[model samples]
Target: MVKLRLKRYGRKKLPSYRIIVIDSRNKRDGKAIEELGFYNPITNETRIDIPRVLQRLTEGAQATRTVQNILDRAQLIAKEEN
Candidate 1:
C-alpha cells in the first residue's frame, strides 16, 4: 500500500514537512517515493504540485487528514475536472 504522508524535517522548534508518497510500511521521515509538496506551519505556507498530486491520488494514494485539508484549501482538484 502507498500513502501520501508528511515527512518531518528542519531545525528543532521550527519544523517543516514535505507531503510525500511512499510505502505505507516505511518509517516516517525515511525514504520518500515522491515529494508532492511542502508545508511550513510556522509560516502558514504550503506548495504542492497539483498535477502530480492528482496523478498520485488516482493511482490510489491516500492522504493524511492534514494533507487532505491542505489540498482542499488549495483546490488541488478543481470540481470541473472531477
Candidate 2:
C-alpha cells in the first residue's frame, strides 16, 4: 500500500515536514515516491502541490490524519454531494 504522509526533517525543536508519497512499510524517513508539499509547524506555513496530491489520492494513496485535516482546512478536497 502507498501512503501520503509526512516525513520529518530539520533540527531538533524546530521540525519541518515534507508531505510525501511512499510505501507503507518504509521507514519514516526512507525513500519517497514523490514530495508533494512542505509544512513548517513553527511558522504555521504550508506549501502544497494540489494537482499532484489529487492525483496521488486518486491513485489510492491514503493520507495521514494530520494531512487530511490540513487538506480539509485548505479546502482542497471536494465534498461529496450525496
Q: How many backbone clashes can be found in candidate 2?
A: 0
Q: lDDT of each structure?
A: 0.91, 0.90
At residue 9, what lDDT does model 1 achieve? 95
* 16-75 per-residue lDDT for model 2 (tens digits): 999999999999999999999998999988888989999999988999899998777666
Worst 10 residues of 2 by lDDT: 73-82
lDDT of 2: 0.90
* Runs of candidate 1 exceeding 4 Å displacement: 76-82
Q: How many backbone clashes does candidate 1 have?
A: 0
Backbone clash count for every predicted candidate, in the order shown: 0, 0
Model 1, range 3-80, lDDT digits (tens) per residue?
999999999999999999999999998899999899999998888999999999999999889889988977854565
